[model samples]
Target chain A: GQQVMQIPQYQHVQEGEDFTTYCNSSTTLSNIQWYKQRPGGHPVFLIQLVKSGEVKKQKRLTFQFGEAKKNSSLHITATQTTDVGTYFCAGQLAGGTSYGKLTFGQGTILTVHP
Target chain B: DAGITQSPRYKITETGRQVTLMCHQTWSHSYMFWYRQDLGHGLRLIYYSAAADITDKGEVPDGYVVSRSKTENFPLTLESATRSQTSVYFCASSESGTSNYEQYFGPGTRLTVT
Candidate 1:
């Protein structure tokens, strides 16, 4: 079974500060996806990284995939109160009939103080 | 609903009772998933369906039953609910398994077993 480990189970940052969370998988992944779940809300799709050493950005958020494709990271610049939520990274196993099934990380809970 | 929608946004039940959460998606996606989210565990997949009448277990499928009788509806059931079953449940759908397409999540159903 595939597993994903995310660092910093919890993070508290001041407004305007930077924050980042990393996801590492014990086995190689075909691809990885990032999601954000606001407190008491459903998770929303943020982005997905497929190629090795890939990087994508959306406004102040940046997502990166490791060269080995077993790790990924999400960094947010100038965090704001609206950025508070639990961020999760889900990885997919390469060989399977149902390859797109995700193994999600424990997640990084972010709290921003204004 | 036009997109994806979950019924009984909140529910409370006794420990030994049985309960069901309903999910309906208008996209007619071939892939539907059920996940439970706890405080630190992030979201753990309970079950998934590739299409109607095709279902598979996920990371945390025990005590949970799922059925996809039709393309647009996927329902999750707890035969005999336990206090441990108290958590937020999310339903997601994707077009297929290869494209790394995004998952569209429902509003989530919050259940409490006492």
Candidate 2:
């Protein structure tokens, strides 16, 4: 079975600080997706990384995929209170029929203080 | 009004009782998934359906059953609930299983089994 591991189970940062969370997969992944879930809210899709050694940016956030397609990282620049939430990384196994199945990491809970 | 939705935002049931969670999507997505969100375990997949009548088990499928009678509906049933089964459940849908597509999650159902 495939597994996705994320680090920094919990993090507290002052406003305007930076944050980063790493994700690793036990096996190669066809793609990896990032999600953010606010308190008392459902998870929302952030971005997806599919290419090897890929990097994508959205406003103040940056995402990177490992060259081996087995690891990823998400970095938030100048975090704000609105950035407080749990971050999750999900990966799909490279081989066989995925059928839209994903292995999710334990998630990194982020807390931002003013 | 044209996205994914889950019924019974909150529920409480007894250990031996049966409980069902309903999910509906208006986009006619081909893939639907059920996941349980625990405190430290994050989101663990329970079951998934590629299309109507095509379902498969995920990482944590014990004591749970799923059916996809039509493209828009996927229901998860707990045959005999347990105390350990208490958690927040999320239903998500995607247009396809490919790596390029992103998932849209519903507001989630919080179930407590006593």
Candidate 3:
């Protein structure tokens, strides 16, 4: 039973402010994926980090994986109203028969105020 | 019509009644997954199917059953729905079962059990 924990259950920031959410796992993860879910919408794949100490960026957003592959962080620069939504980090466990059994974190709800 | 889609965008059923949620994808993806999202919590995997005849249980698959009769269809069945099953269910599909694959999710089905 792998567990993924997320920080900042809720966050409110100005339109131009920056936002970041951290995620950790009790056990080592094979890979980590990030998702964004808009209010009243379903989750959409954002990115995935596989290698240790990996860092990937999508436009103004950056995602990082810990050296041990047990933690990750998603950071956004100059947040906008469109960035208002819940960010989730899911971990894929190693040696599991299921290939993509994503253990999702509690998710961090982000609200951008104008 | 080209991406993943779920049926009955919203549904309300009584406790102990049977309910089924339909999921279809046009990409002929080999991996399909079901997840439930609750307030303040991230999406938790209910079940997943690797291929048409291969299925496996996930973190929260106790009360849910999933079947993959074809590469394009994956449906979830709740034999006897309960209050705890009242939540937003999402169906996601990925072209590959590999850990690096990105998942595409449906619009989601909101189920309310009274």
What are the per-residue Cα lDDT tens digits for candidate 1 across A3-100?
A: 89999899999999999999999999888999998988888999999999999999999999999999999999999999999999999877666636
Clashes of 1: 0
DockQ of 2: 0.87
Model 2 chain B scores worst on lDDT over the 10 consecutive residues at: B95-104
Provide a comma-separated list of chain B TM-scores, one per candidate: 0.96, 0.96, 0.95
Instruction: Kindly state the fnat score of candidate 1.
Output: 0.79
Candidates in descending lDDT order? 2, 1, 3
Q: Can you give the lDDT of residue A93 in candidate 1?
A: 77
- Candidate with better DockQ, 2 vs 3: 2
Ranking by DockQ: 2, 1, 3
Per-chain TM-score of chain A in candidate 1 equals 0.97
Task: List DockQ, one per candidate, in order.
Answer: 0.78, 0.87, 0.77
* Model 3 misplaced regions, further than 4 Å: B97-99
Q: Rank candidates, TM-score, best first.
A: 2, 1, 3
lDDT of each residue in B29-75, candidate 1, tens digit only: 99999999997888899999989999999989999999999999999
TM-score to true structure, per model:
0.97, 0.98, 0.95
